[model samples]
Target chain A: NSKVIQTPRYLVKGQGQKAKMRCIPEKGHPVVFWYQQNKNNEFKFLINFQNQEVLQQIDMTEKRFSAECPSNSPCSLEIQSSEAGDSALYLCASSLSRHAETLYFGSGTRLTVL
Target chain B: GDSVTQTEGLVTLTEGLPVMLNCTYQSTYSPFLFWYVQHLNEAPKLLLKSFTDNKRPEHQGFHATLHKSSSSFHLQKSSAQLSDSALYYCALRYTGANTGKLTFGHGTILRVHP
Candidate 1:
């Protein structure tokens, strides 16, 4: 069974609605990362968190998108206002170390914006 | 910004044929390279990674050699199987960073026909 777990395998939200996805990292893994995979299979890095602390993120993660990895809780990525461009597969990954040499990923949450 | 380049969009082959996927990157600092495979309806999984120059990294039936001079880590396999058909992504991360986030390339779809 996959160690990394993501809830709500699929989500459908209309434009301007809120969309939230949650993830649980692998046991003992401290670094968690979120990536967006588009229909063309292009992967985009969204955010990284090191045990509840923001490590690095891209421009798309700001203002509209909010992500948090709280201690003893599942990490979540939320979109305040969904757009058609935001419809994609959201993947969560965790690494044994902060170096990101090897990562374990979840099945991902497929989000669709209409 | 660090970036990975993969020219191939799709590759079609028959079973037992050899497979080679091109991967190259540009980075300002020492970089770590990786290959990820995503099966149908499955999450992207790490297949291999390389940090040491000229050293090859192999997982399952796939292998890649890191060539620093050419900045390439092309994946290769002796023979392809129908099960091997999947989407492959090449990624890179800075080896000397506190925030080691991956920059991914446009994925290549490998279709192995029986």
Candidate 2:
């Protein structure tokens, strides 16, 4: 029922391995966001973008995470080195505008780090 | 800093019972509140959103009113259904901010048993 599409519904990786996930935001949506949901179900904001420009990102994301929403390309979030702590669901959401009240989310990529 | 608080981590109810999920928030600027529901292995979809004109938003038998004076937006349903079991999150983003960064609550898990 959601237009936002996320790829690789599941990912398995070893520690220090790179884990990359992609998301295609809903059609005509320009604002994209990435959030990490842990086993405890705590939602941690990772990064967000307005069109092709980065808007805001947490410090942890600035260090070990690489995310971008490029024109004509699906938005992606890649972990440089996966850790056990990084084993969680990575959710991508998009909205029609930067101030839009409603957000559409993807099924999310569940990463399992060994 | 903006934060959303969901008082209950889990709520168990029998089918046909009324459902209520409490949510509160603290924000620096004027914000819009929202409720999102995620079924098992599914993407989170917008259940309801607060209106600026004191309008109560509702979808799929669920409703929530934005009480700006109390800084609260609680989800409520007249009766619970078996299909209503899911994770519910309360989120908010400041209207004045150019960035659409949503501060989400830890989420409340609803279990409806027949």
Q: What is the DockQ of each candidate?
A: 0.74, 0.81
- Location of the lowest summed lDDT over 10 successive residues in candidate 1 chain A: A95-104
lDDT of model 1, residue A14:
98
lDDT score of residue B89 within candidate 2: 97
State in Å the error of residue A2, model 1.
2.0
Q: Highest TM-score: which candidate?
A: 2
> TM-score (chain B) for model 1?
0.95
Global lDDT of each model?
0.91, 0.93
Candidate 1 residue A105 C-alpha distance from true site, Å: 0.8
Docking class of 2: high
Cα error, residue B96 of model 2, in Å, equals 1.3
Cα RMSD (Å) per model? 1.1, 0.9
lDDT tens digits by residue: candidate 1, B1-114:
689999899999999999999999998887889999999999888899895656678889899998889999899999999999999999987656577688899999999999
lDDT of 2 by residue, B31-72 (tens): 989898999989988889888899888899999988888989
